[model samples]
Target: MTTRTDSDHDFLASARRTLDLEQQALAALAARLDASFEHACRLILACHGRVVVTGIGKSGHIARKLAATLASTGTPAFFVHAGEASHGDLGMVVESDLVLALSNSGETAEITALLPLFKRLGTRLIAMTGHSGSTLARHADAHLDVSVEREACPLDLAPTSSTTASLALGDALAIALLEARDFSPEEFALSHPGGTLGKRLLLKVADLMHTGAELPLVNHGTSLRDALIEMTRKGHGFTCIVDAEGRLSGIYTDGDLRRTIDHHGDVRRLTIDEVMTFGGLTIEADTLAAEAIRVMEQHRVTTLVVVDTEQRPQGILKMHDLLRSGIV
Candidate 1:
C-alpha cells in the first residue's frame, strides 16, 4: 500500500530509456559484424603466446573483463592497464604475443603511445574502437567497429551504450574462440574447480561413496535382524546383500523391512534374501556424482550400489553423500 510519486515514475522511465538505448546499440553492433571480427578471432587463435589486452578509462574496464572471459574459455589472455604499460608493464608483452587494444575514442594517449613499441617488437595488434579512422585502428592489423549512434547517458557524454557494445563484442569473441577450440564443459570445470560446476563435473561416485568397512554389507541368508544391525552400524539406512562369491545379489532397506512386517507378520525369522529387492539400481564407481544424482532422481530412490565390471559391490552411495558433497 505504498503511494507512487513523481520521482519514482521519472526514475523508472529513465531506466527503461537507458535499457532501450543500450539494446538498440547492441542490435546495431550485431548487424555490422563482418570479416574483421572473424580476422581478430583468427589472429588470437594463431598467436603462439598469450593475448595481452590493454586499454584506458571505461574501455579499460571492458578490456579487463574481456581478458578474464577469454582466459576462462580456452583462450590464454591477460589484461595490462594501458597507463601502466607505458611506465614499465610493456615488457610483459613478447614478440609472439598478440595485443588487443580497446579505446572508445581510438586516440587514448596512454594507449597510442605504445603503438610504435609494439610495431618495433613485431607484436600483432587488433583494435576495437568507436572511430575506425583513428591512429590506433589505422595501425592495427584488424579493426573492429564498436561505434554507437548515441549514448544512453542523457547528456551523451558518460559512455553508456558504447561500453555495452564493447563488452558484448568481447563476449562474442570469447564464445567464438571457445567453440573454435572445441572446448568442453569438463575443461571449463577444471578452470573453475572451486565452484559448484567443478563439483558436478569432477566429482565421481568413488570419491564420495562409503567404502571398506563403512559399507553396510550382509551375506546371503543373513537374518533380517542382523542386516538391520549392519544398516544401523554403517548409518546408510540400507544394507547390500551378496552371495557366497561376494557378488552383489540384492539390497535391503528400511522400507522393505516395513513391507515385510506388513505382509508376513515377520519379527526375527526373515532372511536377507527373503525380502531384499533383487538387483536394485547400481552405478559404476567411476560414474560422475552428478549423473548418480540424475539416476536417483529419475528412479525416485535415495541410494545406489557402486559396482565394478564384474558386478561386485565396491561401495555404497546415498543421496545424503551427494548432498553433503555439494554436488546436488
Candidate 2:
C-alpha cells in the first residue's frame, strides 16, 4: 500500500539517478582520452577503404548508429553484424578496410571468431571495450577504453551507462574526422538530401525564383497604372522598374501604390520613376535561398529582385515562393 506521492517520488528519484550515472560515466570517458584515441582517429582518417563497424547485441545497435554518423559526416562507413561475419559476410571486409569493433566485456565470441581472418586479410582493427586487458583490445591496432564505473540500472547489469559512453565516444570520432576532412555543410547536405538541413543548404536563389515572363517588369518611365498591370499579371506583389539600358533601377510594390494614392490622390498623374523605391534590395541569382530569407526579414519586404553581375534583373523571388518550397 504505497501512496501515489511515494510512487511519484520513487520514479523521479530513479530517473535522476540514471541521468547522473550516465553523465559521470561520460566525464570519466572524456578524462581517459589519450594517445590511443588520437591513434584511432589517424587510422580511420588514413584508411584507404570504408570503415566497417561490427558488434553483437546492444553494442551492435551502437555500432550501426556510429557507422551511419561516420558516413553522413564524410567518412565512408557501413555496419556488419559480427554474428553474420563468420558466415559469408566476411567478404565485406577487405585488405584496405578499417574495422571498428565494440563490446563491453571485450570477449564477444562472434567478433573474436573473425580476428584470425581479419589478421590474415591484413585489415586494421580498432577496439572499444570496457576491459583494456581483454583479447579484443590486445589484438587491436588501437584500443579506446569506454569503461564505465557501474550501470545506471538498480541491478547494475543492464547496458545503460556503458552504451551511452560508447555512443558519445563514437560521436567524438565522427566529428573529429569531419573536421579533419574540412567537411562543409554543403557536403553534409548532399549526403542528406531528403532532410530539412539539405533543403536549407542546397536550395539556391536561382532554383526558387520566377524567371523570364514570370518576372513583373516595367520601364522607369512607365505610368503607375502600367506598373500595377504588370504586377497583377505576374502575381509577385511587386514590379521591377528598369532603366533604358535594361538594368534594374528601382522597384514598386503594392505598398508603394497604396502610399501613392494616399499622398498624391492621383495614381494616373505619377510615373513609375516618380513613385518607385530607388536602389531597392537585390540579390544575386546564385545566392543561397536561406540568405534571401534573411534579407527579406531584415528589410521587411516580401519581394526580392534577382540580378546578375551586371545588375540586370534575371528573376524575382517572393515570400510565398520560399514558403511553398519549404525554404522558410
Candidate 3:
C-alpha cells in the first residue's frame, strides 16, 4: 500500500505551471520576430564558410543543438564553447565564417571577451540575447531578442522560459534558412546518413531486392505444382511467371494456392498462366524502398515484382527484405 501526500499534488501542479509558462514564452517569442531575424538568416545564407555557434552553460547546450539543426538542413555549421574561444579555439573563426553567439544576459564574460577579436577578424556576429542593450548585442551585426518576462522556476532565477525562447528562436532561424536554400529531403538525408531518414531516402529497390538466381521465376506454362515448388524454394511466399521472351507475365502467391485448392479439385493439373494473377503490381528497380513499402501496404500484399523498363523480371522485393534493411 502507498500513501499520497500534499507534496505530491504540489509537485504535479508545479510541473503543469512550468509547462504553461514555457508555452506562453514561446508564444511571446513568436510575436516578437522582426527584421533582425531575417537579417540573421540572410547573413548565414550568404556566408561562404561555416556558421560557428558558441555559448556557455545552459545556453551552450542550446547552441550545440542549433548548430546540429543548421548543419543537417543544408547549412554548414558547428559548435564551439565560448569559454574555450579565448584559448586558441578562436582560430576556428575566419573572415569568411559567420559567428552565432548565445547569452541570456548578453553579459557572459567569456563570450563578450571575444568581441574585440571578432572585430579584428572581421567575422560577422549574430547575437541571441535577452538584453538588446548589452555589449554583445550592441556589437553584433544582428541581435535576436529572446527575452521572457519571467523564468518558470519558482524563484525566477533558473534559466527555464528564457532558454526555451532561445531554442525556439534558433529552430526558427534554421528552418527559415532551410526554406531559403530550397533544401530537399535527399540533401538533408545526405547529412544524416546514419539516421532512419537516410535509410528511407537512400535505399532503393535495386539495393535490397533479390536478383538473378535468387528471384523465384517460372515460365508461364509451368504447372501449378512446379510454381509452388519455386515459391517454397525462394521462401518469398510468391513466384513470378514470365513469358517465352523472358518478360514478366504474371505472379502467383500462397493466397492463390488456397484459392485454387478451393476452386479446383486438383491444382496440380492446372497451368500457372490459368491460375496466376495477370499483370500484377510491379515496381521499378530504381524506386525507393519506402515507396515499395507503401505499395505493399496499400495492396495488402507482402511481396512485389521488380521489373525493368522493358517489363522484364529484374528482381523481387519482400516485406522481410524491408524489415531486415530497416526501411520498414
Candidate 4:
C-alpha cells in the first residue's frame, strides 16, 4: 500500500541516519583505545621488514590507506590483495614481515586461505576485525578488535559502523608507530621537500639571501650622499651600516633618509650613523626564509641584515628576495 514517493523518502532518511550513527561509533572507538594499541605499536617498531597489508572488498580500501600512512610516517609497508595472494602475490610476504589483515566478519575466505601459509612463514599476523573468536583472530599474533554495538545499516548488513571503527583503529596504529620512532619533522621533510612544511624545515635563510657584493652596504662614517648611491646601485631600497669589523651596526633606508630630511633637510652633512635606523631588523644566516618574511612584515620594512653568530653582516634579505623564491 506504500507509494514510490514514500519509499524514496525512507531511503534518504536511512542513508542520513547511517552516516550520523557511524560517526558516533568512530568517536567511541577512539575513547576505548588502550594498551593493545601499544602492543601493536611495538610490533611495528620491532619490524625489520615491510608491513604487508591484506583485506577483502571494503576492508581492502582501509588497508590501502593504512599501508600509505605507515610508509610515509617511517614504517615501511605495502598492500597485498587477499585474493591475489592465493594466485602468486604471497611471495611478497617474507618471513620477517608483519601482516595486517582486515575483515569486518573475521571470516573472509580469501584472507583465511593464507593463514596457514603466514603462520608457517613466521609472519606475525595482526587482525583488524569485529569478531574476536573468528578464525582470523584466533590465528593472529595481535588481534585488534574493531567491533561495533550495532550496524549503522537499518537491516544490520552493510559495513557502515564497523568500517569506521576499523579506519580509526588504523589511524591510531599509524600515529603510535609515528611517535614510537621519534620521527622528526626533518626526516619527514626529506620525504616531502616540495611542500610548504618541507621547504621551511629543509631550506635555510642563506639559500634565499642576497650575498657577496649583491648586498647593499655602506662603510662607517659614509655620508648620506654615498649611502643613497649604494642603495640605488643594489636596488634593495636600503643600505647596511657596518662597523670596521664588518659587523652590522645599523641600517639606513630611503625611509630613514626621508625622515631625516623632514627634520634636518641636509643630506650633505648627515653621516650614515647620524640618519640610519639603529640596530635595524636583522636575522641569523641560518634562520628560515619563511620566518624572514614575518620579520619584514612585522617591522613594516623591506630590508633585513643577515648576520652570522658573531653578529657580522654576511648578507641582506629583501622582501623581493623572498618573493622571487615564491615564499611570499
Name the top TM-score candidate.
2
Error of 3 at 34 (Å): 1.2
What residue pairs are clashing in model 4? none
In angstroms, give how far residue 80 of model 1 lies from its true place. Answer: 0.8
The local lDDT score (0 to 100) that residue 207 gets in candidate 2 is: 95
User: In terms of TM-score, which candidate is stronger, 2 or 3?
Assistant: 2
lDDT of 1 by residue, 177-289 (tens): 99999999989988888889899989999999889999889999898889999999998888999988888999988898789889989568888878999999999999999
List the candidate numbers ranked by TM-score, top first: 2, 1, 3, 4
- lDDT scores for all predictions? 0.94, 0.93, 0.93, 0.85
Query: What would the TM-score be for candidate 3 when compared with the true structure?
Result: 0.94
Q: Candidate 2 — which residues are off by over 4 angstroms? A: 1-9
- Estimate, for each residue in 1-328, the C-alpha lDDT of model 2 and write its tens digit: 7567664667877899999999999999999899999999999998999999999999999999999999999999999999999989999889999999999999999999999999999999999999999999999999999999999988999999999999999999999999999999999999988877888999999999999899888987898888889989988788988988889998888888889888999677778888899988899999999999999999998888899998999998888988998766
Worst 10 residues of 3 by lDDT: 5-14
Model 4: lDDT to the true structure: 0.85
Candidate with more favorable, higher lDDT: 1 or 4: 1
In model 3, the runs with Cα more than 4 Å from the true position are 1-9
Candidate 3 lDDT over residue span 1-328, tens digit each? 7888876668878899999999999999999899999999889989999999999999999999999999999899999999998999998889999999999999999999999999999999999999999999999999999999999998999999999999999999999999998999899889877878999998899999899788999997888888889999888888888998999888888888899889997766898988998988899999999999999999998888899998999998888999999777
Which parts of model 1 are misplaced by more than 4 Å?
A: 1-9
- Which candidate should be chosen as best, given lDDT against the real structure? 1
